[model samples]
Target: MEESMRECMRKLALWHTRTFKPIMTHDELEPIMATLGFLGLPPSASPGGSLAWKEYAHSSSSSSASSGGGGRARPRLPYPRIDGLHSYTYQAFVDGVSSYLEMCDISVLFHIRGMPLHRLDLYKKWRRMQEDESVFVYREGTLDQATYNLYHLHRRGGGGSNSGDGDYINVKMYYGSGDGNGSLVIRDKGNSAPVSCLVPLKDIIL
Candidate 1:
């Protein structure tokens, strides 16, 4: 039953992050608490079920479950604290999801020329990708700006690296005609034995 309680609280923690609002009001929290109140009861557990069976099964202990002719009310159930951090706060919730999430760096490949004239823009690319099942997308716990910058297209690797490191994090479409990206011509500092090659943009075009 402790494990069941932990599992439900973990989902609540996830919801708090998904809404991008971690601070919940007392009234807002009441329903969630009430839902969890019966987790150890007969409707929720199995035969000879749980170590927590006594706590939630005893209706006399809880005001919500008790008759009007009641004795002292029992205290609220403790926070599941599955992450082992005694505190429950926004940072703790963020840490929990970050740990739970399967994170990876993204590489975006796109072409603007194929878009319909009526809706000609880069933002459409994001919307298209969102609808594509092949593309993996997830919502952020907090709102953020979508900052896409237009830069002179630079081929990451034709024969060799463009930057100091061989790794490249970004790839972009050339915005204008007669630009550098179509066959990168790299020359040594001494301007000797210039290397030229093309990183094809055919895969990106619709």
Candidate 2:
């Protein structure tokens, strides 16, 4: 049941990710390109579509064939695409940005640092999610900070955030090929008894 639930969440995040409008192609952005051409400036480093590809590929069968065969595969987008994912739209749904979520998809979740998102090469990612992403975050800070502060606030001992709600877990999928994943745990990070924040999205028949 837990496995199925995780898969469902992964798909939900992916389905949500694919629903958005894709990158705009070069032709669709012509007015901007024209202005760039006038100023003797290059177009967008990586405009969305096939035209952007042709620009770098140099079209082996066309007039630029002479250059295509010998030249390096240069990026046409001026800047790297990795630099473009900083916006909120690209944040994980767990982070409160539901639009272009990349976090929970199993292919992206089990391992860390997958890039170009479209390319799903499993071997490329070396670290497991738990190792890098499992640190708990509380409201304004981390689970460690929140709990420690709450402890002090109660005893009149130290400054605290005054609360212990785990809002927004940086969720990730667990994949074990069946070994380490089965290792059960009694406590979460910060050495505190774990709290289960998961809520059922929908259900019935109690």
Candidate 3:
């Protein structure tokens, strides 16, 4: 890692060591993004007929709060349509986001730092379309700050877009407790654990 990147990791480690503690539930954590100036990151656009999608995805799953069914099935809304994108859609983005959360363990430093979230080549596996997208992840637990910083570097293009034979960024995803402070993670190539960064949607080009 470059000196600047290493320094960033140290800072993240310090922050994590200091703030490691219990985290709030997803409901309590959503508001912090807005309060922390991430409100405009992306407009809350749900796609039309999402209810139908949910109804189909979990047709047999029961809507029990005690069971694991409460958090996954969300009401569908109208989202913006990406013109000319062969496979991109709000559903793909949502699927990718869900996979990241379900599969990746965001608490460990080395484990989380090795996630392949930005690998467009593996879009088919993640069930995402080839189009512009924005995603987010949040959880509660202890994380190695340096690992988190490495993830941010990947997301911000600091990690050169190269991974072996494929053109990609080798960065792992990030994890944050729902306490307002958090990191963003993306995938490239097959799967990459990326560095974390606070990317505001207003600054995003896609």
Q: Whose TM-score is greatest here?
A: 3
Candidate 3: tens digits of C-alpha lDDT, residues 101-186: 34233334111121123233222222111122322111111212333354335535543222201111222323344321223344
Would you estimate the TM-scores of all the predictions?
Answer: 0.15, 0.17, 0.22
Q: How many clashing pairs per prediction, in order? A: 0, 3, 31
Ten-residue region with minimum lDDT total, candidate 1: 105-114
Largest lDDT belongs to which candidate?
A: 3
Q: Which stretches of candidate 1 lie over 4 Å from their true place?
A: 1-21, 38-206
How good is model 2 by TM-score?
0.17
State residue 128's C-alpha deviation in candidate 3, in Å: 21
**Candidate 2 lDDT, 1-206, residue by residue in tens:** 83332222211011111222223333332333233221112333232322212222222223334232334222132111221211111122112111112123222221111112222322222211122222111111111223234333442442211111111222222222322111111224354333343322121101
lDDT of 2: 0.23
Higher-scoring candidate on lDDT, 2 or 3: 3
Is 2 or 3 the stronger prediction by TM-score? 3
> What is the lDDT for 54 in model 1?
18
lDDT of each: 0.23, 0.23, 0.26
What ranges in model 3 sit over 4 Å off? Answer: 1-54, 57-60, 63-101, 105-193, 204-206
